[model samples]
Target: MVVNNGIANDARVIKTAAALRRAGAEVTVLGIATAGGPREETTAGGVRYVRLPVFPRRGATAAYLRFALARRAAHLVRDPRRWQRTLPSLRWYQRAFTRELRALDPDIVHAHDIHLLDTVARTWPPHRCPFVIYDAHEYVADLAVAGRRTRREVESWAAKERDRISDADAVITVSPEIATRLAAEHHLPRRPTVVLNAPVRFDGPADPGAPAGPVRSLRAEVGVSASTPLAVYGGALSTARGLGTVIEALPLVPDLHLAIVAVPYPHPMSQELRELATSLGVADRTHLIEPVAAHEVPAFLASADIGVSAILGTAASYDMAMPNKLFEFLHAGLRIVTS
Candidate 1:
């Protein structure tokens, strides 16, 4: 299995690996290592992780020049301008990923996204190509709009994704909505399988007379008294996630305090959010906590009275998303107020 992001914090990837392992399959995840993380490690479920080093995006000036010159040279023969800008960064990673993946010589290659499918397709031998599973974690083409990628870049990805899907042996998507759209949009041969990002369910009863779970004094940690009602929002602190709306609503509900337990990625809006809270005169009522491990999410969420998921419908992907945080809140038995 291959994924672009670091495996340490990817709940879906971790859960998928664990499930595969439990089903008597040997799982090895290839991913990009987080800074200060080991290049290789084994998880508790016996899943092996192999991380490949990525090259610095800014320092590849010579490579970028070469790519530009190559594009000009190829332009005369065939149009290469469509992927010119993305090639500079994508080229190095593609080469490195291809090298590492080829060495594994696996029976199956499960690529997590359309971006990695190019490398997988390029590396696998044509005559003896392994069964490839294209796992579409989201409506990837729409992700360009969500992430604010350029039009050219978005078009490039859309074309590549459409081409890659046709070559894939099978496809898997996170939701039925996404599956239906992807098939129609890409003109897929068959509808992709819907694999909901549901949390693991334990069937057996808890240990009799076992020690109680660890206590979390959220009010104490945030320097608030027990009388204050806490509204918790956990997940990525991005603008599209609609965290700012929650901050804006604080003044209207003066008695409610918000605790944001989030992982800031791509953009950390914490400082901006703090400023917003301060401007609204709710700074004291707002609390920002670092994200916790997936195993601890339920306990952390249980410490609050209400769970908030006010995602803005800025893009099609966000509008269609059934985020795992929603399920986490439900499983934690917290009252949900979602957009």
Candidate 2:
């Protein structure tokens, strides 16, 4: 399975790999190493995980120069199109990914998301390739695009998807809406299989008599009492997430406390949210907790009174999507409050 991000927090990838492994197939998840993560490791489920660095560790001066350029593209460049077009890191990762794939030479290759299409295509030329499954995590073409240039960037991805969709032995996606759009837009022979981003439903612990581990709680983390009406938002801390709106509404519901459990805790957006909360005079009620592990998410969120999906319809993907957090909230048994 090929995904761009480190496999540590990617619940879908981990679950899929585990399922494939249980079915007697050896699974290896190839991805790019996240900040401070090990390049090579194995998951508890016994799946091999290899994460290649975006930049080469030992290479010629030109390679390092290209790495510098990529870093510049990431930090200095404001235009998304220019960032994507000029960045060499994607191609560098592609070459490294293709090399690892060649070494493994698995019978079946499952490429996750549109970003890894080129990597898979390079590894196995269409006609001669092994069985490949394309997992469309989102409607790439329908993603939020700001200007004409960014639209062109999305168009390039659409073109790539259009070209490669036919080559995939099977295509699966996160939602039926995305599946329908993919078929209609790409002129596919058949709609992709719909696989909702639902959590794996297991009964209780394997040993029913065994003591349960201490469950993390949003209320406990936020230092909120059992009676405090805590609303939890667990996902990316971004403008499109409509968290600002949620913060704004907090002033109206003076008694309700808002807890955001997200990654990259000290993020610019996190600061922005803090400022927003302070400005609205609800700072005391707003809490931002660092993200917990994927396995602990449901139990962690279970202590909250409500799960909030304050997604603003800023993009087509957001409009017709079933976010993983929604299912997690359901599993946690939290009452849902959406935008």
Considering every candidate listed, which one attains the maximal TM-score? 2
lDDT top scorer: 2
lDDT of 2 by residue, 48-72 (tens): 7788765555445776767767665
Query: How much lDDT does each candidate structure score?
Result: 0.73, 0.77
Clashing pairs counted in every model: 0, 0
TM-scores for all candidates? 0.84, 0.85
Candidate 2 Cα RMSD (Å): 4.3
Candidate 2 ranges beyond 4 A from true positions: 35-38, 56-64, 67-90, 125-128, 146-149, 202-214, 265-268
Global lDDT for candidate 1? 0.73
